[model samples]
Target: MDSPHGAAVKAEDFGLKGPRGWAFRGVGIDAAPGSLIAVEGPSGSGRTCLLLALTGRMKPTAGHAEVGGHQLPKKMSAVRRIAALGPVSGVTDLDQALTVAEQLREGALLQRHYGAPVRAMLRPRAERRAAAEARIASALEAAGLDLAALPKGERTSVRDLERLESVRLSVAIALLGSPGLLALDDLDLKLSDTERAEAWALLRSVAARGITVLAVCSEAPADALVLRTGPVDPDAPDAPQDAPDAPVEAAEPAGAEGDTKNDTTNDDTNDDTKGADDALAEAGRA
Candidate 1:
């Protein structure tokens, strides 16, 4: 189904400052609905900050942006409600203790309560539940997650899921609310060459479905509209070096973090459908 509120993003010399200095500066982006845009840069180059700022999660110091028709740094709240982020450090990380099914169900419930319409709130319990299930089912299908094929099936805990599976689950959760725009961090973080290719294919498929996608990656695909960021320049006169108490930008390192696993391709069957089905059942139980 096509999105009722899909909106393009346009930024003109957009910039933001953090305690350490400018997280990102002089950035520009113009992406249409259903397009794929990549924010490419090294670690600590303020890519994440830029993602947050564009999505209305952070305020910018200079320049301006309009997301989904709302001017950013001003109508940030409106943009935030329409743009969803996943794998964002403090925003959408998975809980290691929860099973895959449990997480999906919880995400759906949260979306129903927080993102659903007033009519949905007043609907009969059964009708509301059916609607939620339909949403989860559609989202899982769209994300291409096969819950059954997971190592432990639907009962598989997040800690036990492989990196790719974890990524799929996070994407599924983000899609639960059907936001017009989706933003993801670390698109190729720990994947091997083959995995990275598969991940890119998946994102491409997403964009083809009419929802705009913004991805943060060390290296963006050839076809994506790319925006590059770099570390703050202290040599600039407006740099925060003179400030006695400027804080540090404690952002994560630029490339593939946390997973010390090898970058070589793994030929593990990409069967995520089974796990996705189980997750639906689990969500229903919740």
Candidate 2:
């Protein structure tokens, strides 16, 4: 729960639509500070859309919502400042080519550049670097992740990370922002029953520390507040797990982030990865 920091979420008639049809409609919810909200629904059920809408990454075409008492749609930019995205595909996906250390370093640089206070940003390069390291250490501890456990430790590539490890890494990266609300997509995608339980437990612990969590999954644990966008139709044909929303409004990158209104594609993503790689290499030399 939030006392000093955290966001409460409330919505009334929340909905969004694209050119093709309605993404989601007529949804309402009220979650206290530090609540674990599960956006549970089958694939193609607009779960991801709802998740983005709540986090101020995507605009809602209808009704109103609030985060930490800051209203949505109208107060989207303010909402974005306190809400951080984790593991949202086409939004915050990890580059398979980048190692764990590189990812952390790049995110730290961006967090300091764009999200840190003016005084913090004015620090000398060495001091800034040390602060980043401390932030990474604190985030990793909160995420229950240890680099020493990996085969190559910090050098492990994103492609080589286990499903749960990826989740933890994503959570850590977002936590680097010191957000009041953390939102993640595809929370239990490829995990076994045991791993699924562990994921929920980690989220619960994070919530215990007073940061609200919003997770998207096909199934939600009993402890979370379930917000269903639509019912699962087992009879219908299956949809691919990671299909992007139809004409999805482009989302901001974890680095160089400003607003999520710009359009981006695969080619744009490659450029970002190359830029991060170059920056990281330069940082390593210094």
Candidate 3:
């Protein structure tokens, strides 16, 4: 869209614990505005949790972070306003039933209605519609998504998109908000070597445009600022005895409140699933 106006992102001693263990802990990152950062770890290592925590989609139990000039936990609402999530399973998942064009239209509309200034909303209907179209066009161009290249063009359902196409679509939608920081999950999941290269290049281009990018990947690429996560040391004195059973969901409307209950058993199931997936990958490599 417009020239980059990326905001600096920083975290110190950031940690998030769940009942199963520390989803991620002792994490620290100092990324300048417009930097490309990769959170690298195998499944169950809490990469997703880290992504959510940085984007203000999940709360951190300890430590502190600043995103887009907003202090997290304290100014989470403000952080959420300047940061956007793409393809974060529980946070920004695309609707499978929708067509690519439909998704783009909806994302632009949501951004305009939820993120635009009140003065902008007071504009004439035709002008607002035109502005939305301009934004979608800019995002599409910047994301390098050619909707017409898809099998069914813009009418292609999200369920039908190839892995790379889905990634591009999600990036395009996230761009509609013109956010200062963007977070994406599963950056390299299910992609061939060539596709992986393309994805990395795309992300690099995004960073070059002035949007700080935080991505979750199974392995970090050579070009990114990397953060590696490991299993929690239970014997450590700082180990948390009580932790959230599940991750807190994304932000609700301002002033809205919700409670997250502990379900340690469910947490175990999630851990098991992640472990199994990691095992399968390891076996395939062997």
Instruction: Tell me which of candidates 2 and 3 scores higher on TM-score.
Output: 3
Clashes of 3: 0
Give the Å shift of residue 285 in candidate 2.
Answer: 30
* Model 1 / residue 87 / CA error / Å: 1.3
Q: Give all TM-scores, in the order shown.
A: 0.81, 0.82, 0.85
lDDT of 2 by residue, 63-152 (tens): 789998989778776777788888876567787899999999988877877776688777898998887898899889888889999989
Q: Using lDDT as the measure, what is the rank order of every candidate, best first? A: 3, 2, 1
Each candidate: RMSD = 11.6, 8.7, 6.1
Query: How does residue 3 of candidate 3 score in lDDT?
Result: 62
> Model 3: per-residue lDDT, tens digit, 1-286?
5565787999988876645556667788899999999999877767777776787656677778898788866766677777777666544667999999899998887777677777988999999988888888898887889988888999999999998888888888888877788788888999999999999999999999999999989888998999986666766655342345433444321112232222122221224445223322322222
After superposition, candidate 3 runs with Cα above 4 Å error: 239-286
What range of 10 consecutive residues in model 1 has the weakest lDDT sum?
Answer: 260-269
What candidate 2 gets wrong by more than 4 Å, as runs, is 1-4, 231-257, 263-286
Evaluate model 2: give its lDDT.
0.73
Error of 1 at 107 (Å): 0.6
In model 3, pairs of residues that clash are: none
